[model samples]
Target chain A: MSEHILETQNLTKEFKGFVAVSNVNLSVKTGHIHALIGPNGAGKSTVFNLVTRFLTATTGKILFEGRDITTTKPADIARLGMVRSFQISAVFPHMSVRENVRVALQRATGSAYHFWKSATSLNELNARADDLLEQVGLLSHADALTVELPYGRKRALELATTLALDPRLMLLDEPTQGMGHEDVGRITDLIRKVSANRTILMVEHNLSVVSRLCDRITVLQRGAVLTEGNYEQVSADPQVRAAYLGGSHAA
Target chain B: MTKIQARNRLYLLLVAIVIGLLAPLVVYPVFLMKILCFALFACAFNLLLGFTGLLSFGHAAFFGGAAYVTGHALSVWGLPFELGILAGTLAATVMGAIVGKLAIRRQGIYFAMVTLALAQLIYFLCLQAPFTGGENGQQGIPRGFALGILDLSNNTTLYYVVLVIFSLGFGLVYRVINSPFGQVLKAVRENEPRAISLGYDTDRVKLTAFIVSSALAGLAGATKAVVFQLASLTDVHWHMSGEVVLMTLLGGVGTLIGPVVGAGVVVTLQNTLSSGPLNAYVPVVLGGIFVVCVLAFRRGIVGEIKALIKQSF
Candidate 1:
């Protein structure tokens, strides 16, 4: 837990001759907020997909917690204590907020297959589920259907569900995408609060949030790491500025 | 489930039980029994399509496969009623596991196609198999006694037995849909990727549900064979599969009681109409009703009613 929680060695992915993520080496240390930042089409999502096994790597290896997971299934990767949250705040929309958390908690009760027992039996986990909801400041909306929740609230519920898994490492894909300034500030604080005793690897576009939250930052350009350092060093890197400015109209 | 929702379902069940117990005095027990069998069939199908969002087009394989097994068990093996139904259910469970394993690998319409194709293979096997009696089907399956005690030869007695089986099957469906397992099933239905990311082996979850639903469907089929003492090609036919889907949709797809209500209406119409002057137009009429139901309210009868009740509150 004190060393690297996730390591990818010369990882590469290609779609029929077009390289999407290429020869990238990434090592995320434990108990820290590690940010993967690049401009659009920088293969951030591709590397995530490769490590999570959503797509097979063209070449190279991935190791999580000292075990090779290059060929593992996505669910197995998660089961191995590397849970991922989607960019869009993936959740069971029709279920209540509490129910969403409970779904993740069901596996831990060791009775996820008990179809004969009443669901009320799962009420034992209600307190724990509520605590998760409370941790994310969503206790008041526990009974509300997830689809009925406002956009920001849905993101919080997603975090609660992710926390319910309590993985050793959490992969968040754009956890604060498409949010207002106030919502982003609130979520940044929430993520910081939840990062204790666990590793968080995030692919984020918002640099201010990254500099504010991440302990270490990896900058990618064209599917390969351009620089890896603290926020100040990465921000001061001339290549990082050129990649960002030339790649976008922001300048 | 919430206390209020559970109580509401309990009340609804009570009402249905009263009707089931007393209706035989006025209605022909055989007709009522047919309705019960199809109702159970529809309910089993709903567990997959309604609850789990899997649309299977080959359910008749399970239904009719169990019927043939039950028929053989009672007639050839001379087993008791309970054992015969259990044999049939076991056969369907095996079938479900195999079919689910293969079919669930594909998704959506491909899943439907896989089941349909596999069912057709089973249908052909039934037609060619020596024990199945080919076109004649397995016939004269004795109702036999329940545990060698009560006489199943009596229509009323058999009707009550069928009622018990239906109740058990329905209750099992209810418990499963409200169980911890059911939550994961719904989660998979709602968002499969999210479920997968949560460390759920979704294929396994889906397969388990398929087996349960198939076993229940087989139970209905076996019971029907016992009640009528016959298992025919019609039982395994694609039309039978289509008919169950119609029943589920006409009533309500996802609602617990929707399939039952749908089966009752469909069976009643098929009975009263096909046996009367409107027999030739029975299919047309049923088709028309299905069209109207889809167009006017795609949620079906029970779903629409539930929506209205929710709206009022």
Candidate 2:
């Protein structure tokens, strides 16, 4: 069996005259938390966009579970057990938290066209949504409108919704981008808990978060991989230090 | 079970229907039927604009196309009432599919424009078609018996028949808006991108809503042709489309009961004003109402009342 859940060979993306991500090779092993860390304009989000089928790769191939999915639509890719969470909080703001999760569950469970059945009567769907919300510690706010929740709570809701898709691979873009340290710690813990049975490929700017959560880290500079190893190994490497981390740390 | 808040709503509707049925005995049955027809038309329009967040300017296609079909079927081919209505509805469904396929390619203001242009094209087609009697329209349509038993030629019997069909159509609209599909439509209106990311094919949902709305509009139009015993070019005119829109907006855009109330108000206003010398100014009044509704009362009358109720509760 293939160890890689997702693999990209020489993936490249260009917008007009600028190359956002160039000549990148990335592989995420099943049940591993792989973090991609870099400064601004490192094309981390661009790489995510390409992999998720939101943006077509200018050149190269993407393989998921050893099957090529380079030409699949985003929704089709998502249905095939790979889901992504946006960098900015994305949620149905007017819907109650429970409804948001139920919609996703409905999509996952193949009931998208059952119009006559009252959504409230779908006790199984509600129970499943409740369970996922409880997992994210958001069960208390289940009936609250999504717009009313705090920012961190909104992020938690996004995770619950994504989890409702029953994905085998999860792509997270800056999960804790604007969170306070305490909230960051809680979210990091949540990510760790979710990473147990799923492959997680995350683009994180916060070095401490990458150090704490990642099993292996890949450093990128100018859209190319500068180095890849465990945090200590990549952090101390002379070439990675010069290109990305800067010489002060190595000196 | 939980105090049945909708019971009061049921009671109000029952009272209104009773009064409507009794109106012809005291006033005029033909006029009452016309009002009921317009009321149903506005309700159907509201299903798309208020609940689904789609503003269809081509509703005239459904309404007018059904009128022409129902009129021709009743007067020329001599079909029964129910079959005529069904034929009319099928015609609208076909038109809905064609227009929906094209209109859904755009969003917001462009959506309105695309539907409007399509409706205008239909209006011209109706003008040129031989069966429609061209500019003169088909007149003297027979109000045949319901299932060949109800004797719809009798003014009282025909009035009741129209009343029942209108009530059923309105009830179905209410039921659809309260369904899960309706909630998803609201979610799409509130945020399209979020709904898409949540795995909904938003385009499919919108298309379904559009077809349903058009079919119901056809139902209303067919009933009107039977009641008035005429189907004229006026039914398909762009002004008729604007009138239904105005009714929905004045009553309340998103509220379930607003469109019915708006339909009643506009029909009543037009009837009363037509008898006086000021009849020519009805369009100006409608224009003013639209401007006022947009500028000062974006929520419409029903939305305002609901807000007040929420505050009081």
Cα lDDT for residue A83, candidate 1: 92
Docking class of 1: high
Rate residue B64 of model 1 by lDDT: 97
| Chain A TM-score for each of the predictions | 0.96, 0.95
Instruction: List candidate 2 segments past 4 Å from native.
Output: A14-18, A37-42, A218-229, A233-251, B1-27
TM-score of chain B of each: 0.98, 0.95
User: Where is model 1 more than 4 Å wrong at Cα?
Assistant: A247-251
What tens-digit string does per-residue lDDT give for candidate 1 at A54-118?
88999999999889998998888888899998888798999999999999998777777899998
The DockQ scores of all candidates, in the order shown, are: 0.83, 0.41
Local accuracy by lDDT, each model: 0.92, 0.86
What's model 2's TM-score?
Answer: 0.90
Candidate 1: residue pairs that collide: none
Candidate with best lDDT = 1
